[model samples]
Target chain A: MENNINDDNAPKTCEYDPNVNQDELIKAQEKQIAEEIKANTAMVGSLDGLSSLEEEYSNDPVYSSKVKTLLPKFSNVRRTRPDGNCFLRGFIFAYLEYCIHHRDELVRFKKYLESSKEELFEIGFPKFTTEDFHDMFMEVVSDLEGSGSIDRVEAVCNDAGTSDYLVVYLRLLISAHLQKNAEFFSFFIEGGRTVEEFCKQEVEPMYRECDHLHIVALTAAVGVGVRVMYLDRGEGDALVSHDFPEDKEPIIHLLYRPGHYDILYKA
Target chain B: MPMFTKLAHKTSTAAKSSGQTAAKTAAAAAAAKGNVTSPAGKHFLDNTRWQKRLQKELMSLLKEPPPGVTVDVDQAHTKLTEWVVHMEGAAGTLYEGEKFQLQFKFSPKYPFDSPEVIFVGENIPIHPHIYSNGHICLSILTEDWSPALSVQAICLSIISMLSSCKEKKRPPDNSYYVKTCSANPKKTKWWYHDDTV
Candidate 1:
């Protein structure tokens, strides 16, 4: 049905202007449509019930088993829009929400973040850029104090500017972590790429997908543990869980599919 | 050089007045007044984060500018969106002793969005990549722009572009493009095919 409409439109364009390069025009139109679709989708969404997951995996036994396991321990999943930056966004929202519950952890995280600013500046990030991101991050975190509500957190996280700024700051922190401890991280980096190179190629860019190396560096940098539960087709009755900052309890839980990550909230 | 310094000094003072504090007060007032819309019906509220970021950038650039770059806001004591950067051609290059001006127009979604940057001045540089009407065909100013790049880095890139030119010449299509191109070069889909200019 869609193909017939496209075919009809194609002949009409040639009729209007025979000189026009129809192929190039069609390609440009497709590109514009793709960009519009990307722009309309949010990077992160509000809290949603886990019924969607059940509906999604109802037919697939492997995924169904994973969902069944998660359903008993988790009540809700705040879905981060799968825009490549999902891991960072998921980590941030989950961590901030955790801070909202644990006051002392929030205080410690604030101090760590304050000191991390100087570390970022020392690593050759211009003071202006670092300060700008740091200030916005601090403002968002501070708002979680006292009467700060989850609704306010969701609003700010959903705001394009604030959310992107926070993501960039986290990327910087991850870069700083890897660079600061290059000797340790260099050992893990594959393909002869140095820690700095990895950060530039993988960590610094806004849309780069997060890898295990990124997860480790970020978890270490922010002084938080994250448990990523993998739900895949691999043979397993239970979901595979990998904890960052090994041997420690994780406060933040993330559900990881093939190429995306979202926050997992325990009941 | 002295004129550049004076201009920088003047702009810094102007920026101080309309910087963070002024933006905060404006935001507070807007909040109190409630739903202030512009003549165009767009919200009249300032993006405080963008204002603060630009203000900090302006302050830092003024305090410790890169070796060959001098920057000043386009308008004095007003919006921080537009900036005029002056670049001195690096010594020992074809453009040594030459000066150029670049106009940078930033959107509220700055850092995330690349600023619309173009060369501007009476005497535009005669370079293969730089058009007669001061449109620069540089990747970093367009597709290659990264949030990690700063105004200083852009100025340095432009200076280096001028410095590397062995012969002074306008782009091959300079005349035709200048006549037909839009006022804002950002709208142009520039095909940067040349490298050794």
Candidate 2:
């Protein structure tokens, strides 16, 4: 008896082309779908909170305008690429949050910083030893404490060299200290005045540029900053290699002449 | 199905023409009776040594994870050559609860060649440095990659990178992502620069 092809009990026939590998094709499709789901889920989960913070900041006209202006300038160099450095990105956001919160004080300090830069040039750069870097740190602290922005200065000091949070404050401090100041460069010369001379004449007056409390707070932060050089290098290189730390110390080789300092440790 | 049939016919024809000895023929005949392993089968079998090593390491990690992190490996729908991992970090800001998909494409060279890793996600955050596609711009993944570097090291570096991000800005050309991204994102290579983050 011949089977009826149209009967429901008849064996199923696949209508697909014999040349195609359906199983392989289906697996490929499934893989693609899985990847799509994974990617979308990751992005949505990470960005939701940041978007809200951005929304609030975007609403403030003055703050938004400044951010817009500064962003373009700061980011012009890396236009085509993405920054993979997450810690640095976080530090920058934190600093921006700081500036936005302290806008009025920032305005005042920016003005003082502009004038101080000129003085920095006239007074000259110091060949700061570890002690000089410390002294510089203390001087900034005293000035910050006097300025009544001691709280801001203290917060900065506490977090110093620990994260990139200090970069913003350091940028502000450097701007205030170095503007129009060509003299600070003099001490960096090979045979220039010792760090002692440079500290006495140049860094000592940093206190005058801002309130004494503010100066002291900033000074203490610098003490931490100077040590970042060590942390940046971390526990030295082993032959087999080791995982590098996230919070790298600043590459502070700038203060010491090329061959002068090799003590290596902070002791 | 067609491909398998074609391979089967070809293997049978070759076996008939070769006129192999009975002992060797019996082994192949048995293999064919069960399943016809492809030409790449030998390499795949040998390649599992490294795969096994990686899997064991991953399993050990899952049992006792690092601070602020969790990881999972999925093998359900991949080419045996590909390994996919999912990561989450609880302690880190901006990245907390964020799941990142890392796909690894191992080359035939195995442990010698570092696997290609890409973050696959749409609507990924743009930082001044991060491109629309999740190609990281760090040195370790490229010129600085050493055999000593492991999957955990790379993940940790990524976590650290996210934690340190200060600007919260995306790549400057984020608006162009839709225009420039390829139909198949995995094929595109990313350009990385800037020592200062």
Docking quality category of candidate 2 according to DockQ thresholds: incorrect
Which candidate wins on DockQ?
1
- The pairs that clash in candidate 1 are none
Q: Which candidate number maximizes lDDT?
A: 1
How would you encode candidate 1's per-residue C-alpha lDDT over B74-158 as one tens digit per residue? 4613768888888887889887888888888987666766688888888788888787788787766654455666887677677
Candidate 2 per-residue lDDT over residues B98-150, each given as its tens digit? 66666666543333234566666543544454555665445445323332345
TM-scores, all models, native as reference: 0.73, 0.30
Cα error of candidate 1 at position A219, Å: 0.4
> Per-residue lDDT of A62-106 in model 2, one digit per residue for the tens?
444433433322221111001111122222323233334566644
In model 2, what is chain B's TM-score? 0.58
Which prediction has the highest TM-score against the true structure?
1
TM-score of 2: 0.30
